[model samples]
Target: MGKSERNITNWKQYNQALVNRGSVTFWLDEAAVNAWHCTKHHGGRGRGFQFSDTAIETALMLKGIFKLSLRATEGFINSLFQLMKIPLIAPDYSCISKRAKRRCCLNKRNLFRFP
Candidate 1:
């Protein structure tokens, strides 16, 4: 039995391919941008939420997808925003954690469903 080996003939294309593998393309639609901030007031005693549910869900989704810690997730999102030149701010790690717990409760009650 013999094993076949492959060799790179063009270093330019190979290097380009490697660079492209690390590139990530992301964009936020206008509707998503509009829904990023909380508009409705809960009329609570303390301060109201700045970011909407959509934002929190987005952060949590990214966290799970990237397998990143809460703080790392926050930085990742903020960096994405910076790259996109968007003025939006990422939700704090603590806020994401709290919302994640709440979302778990809602899921247990079958109140939240993902499509």
Candidate 2:
């Protein structure tokens, strides 16, 4: 009503207040870095070598963001993410979802067979 920046005098502090990621050390472990590197390079083939650091972060962001549904979140990541800013190693939603589904610890498929 009064000024365009009214009530938001300390925007920097306010923005910083929302940045509660716990810690970066645990998230960026050596194993994670190695995995990123391997994924980026396509297991040393150098096919996806152009991948950047942001790509991995973006992918992870998507997993957490769309925790309930793999389809929606991955679609968003693929379409909205800036390819140039992220690494080429980043895979589409389908790829991630398929891997997740396969790895899921679901009930044994044949355990309940009635035959």
Candidate 3:
């Protein structure tokens, strides 16, 4: 074997990291769900939302991380909540799409800001 291929570097650490990735303990905490409610306020009719901004952000993160479609992301989050036995409601795929669109539109306006 060539010198470059002769030795395995940090193979144990790499293996452990891979193992750790499968553990759901990281984002499955009750605090993660609770943080969503702390800032939620019902300002008026049609203004109150069932899911929190944090929940939406988390769903987006999961969608990108797992390469899921909007519908699939909804199902994925639902399953996670069920597994965790948390009494939280999951947002629908359409909700995700709407929020993502609004977020993109806002970001576009901010993209041209100089300061």
Candidate 4:
């Protein structure tokens, strides 16, 4: 036998499936969002951190997963927030870099957990 033949009978359904395949879904847990900003103050001379460690970790995780540069990672996170209609801001690239450098050792924790 040669190559098999296929028929397209449902054009609308086929088109919809194609579009759905390219669609992506993202959501932020309310608890995670609440923890995005650091609430505990370290009582330092200079200004304290605005974003929490979880936020920075999440940003760095995204950067690594997407293979994006620092600036691009910031932009990507900001865009995701905007798309989700969340009144939150992503950590700037500089902040990410600073925090990333400050980490002495990487902990054995799952960084990709959402819930």
Candidate 5:
């Protein structure tokens, strides 16, 4: 095939997929909400925390989805918990930052990769 004649065979499908990318979605199920509670950090100097790894991880996921700062993520999560009537505590920005550093590095490609 000539250079000008060579093009993506599925260009229309690709365009549709690109347009659908804007409809981002995030969900926290009932089971997850029930499991979202503070757990004791073994061997840590301080007392047990009020937000478990699940909560932190969830907030991190939303942070990427919503393109929010750490503090904003915390607030957003807190609001969501309140709105859902889930009596769970939200992690502060500093707590999120510290825990996030210990948990994993930021890899936008891995988190935001489509399909």
Candidate 6:
């Protein structure tokens, strides 16, 4: 076993696996993001004052752009947003609740549009 790709038969220590992956930098370009922005979900409430493009954009970015965990995803989104010049980083587990593999946040869905 001189070959670098060979898998160790026993767990001695320093086990490594080589993964061939496409770089994120290639995909995070403006063209890709702009396309995603146009297709992202637009939840309906018959708007008088609805959620900003930023909130939805952040949500989409977490779920699609960065492909982060819902907890981490929501955390990232919350961190970037501001309410009346205040940082809106709410680390609420219930913010991305999962009862049966389906996320549900009844309160936050209607929580002043993440303003």
Which runs of model 1 end up more than 4 angstroms from their true locations?
A: 1-23, 104-115
User: Which pairs clash inside model 3?
Assistant: none
lDDT of 4 by residue, 1-115 (tens): 9765978899999999999987766687888888999998858788889999889988888787677898999999999999988889999999999988774223346534432
User: Can you write out model 6's per-residue Cα lDDT over 26-115, one digit (the tens) per residue?
Assistant: 223444334422343346565332233433444544554565666776666555444223433433444333321232222334422232
Q: Count steric clashes of candidate 5.
A: 0
As for model 3, its CA RMSD to the true structure in angstroms is 5.4
lDDT of 1: 0.82
Best by lDDT: 4
Of the two candidates 4 and 5, the one with more favorable TM-score, higher being better, is: 4
Q: Report the number of clashing residue pairs per model.
A: 0, 3, 0, 0, 0, 0
Please report how far candidate 6 places residue 85 from its true position, in Å.
Answer: 8.9
For model 5, what is the C-alpha lDDT against the true structure?
0.77
Instruction: Give lDDT for model 2.
Output: 0.46
TM-score of 4: 0.68
The model with the greater TM-score, 2 or 4, is 4
Sort by lDDT, top down from the best: 4, 1, 5, 3, 2, 6
Q: State every prediction's TM-score relative to the real structure.
A: 0.68, 0.32, 0.63, 0.68, 0.65, 0.28
Clashing pairs in 4: none
User: What does candidate 5's lDDT look like per residue over 46-74, in tens digits?
Assistant: 77766777777887888887899998998
Candidate 5 regions with alpha-carbon error over 4 angstroms = 1-27, 112-115
Clashes of 4: 0
For model 2, the superposed segments whose C-alpha errors exceed 4 Å read 1-34, 37-61, 79-84, 104-115
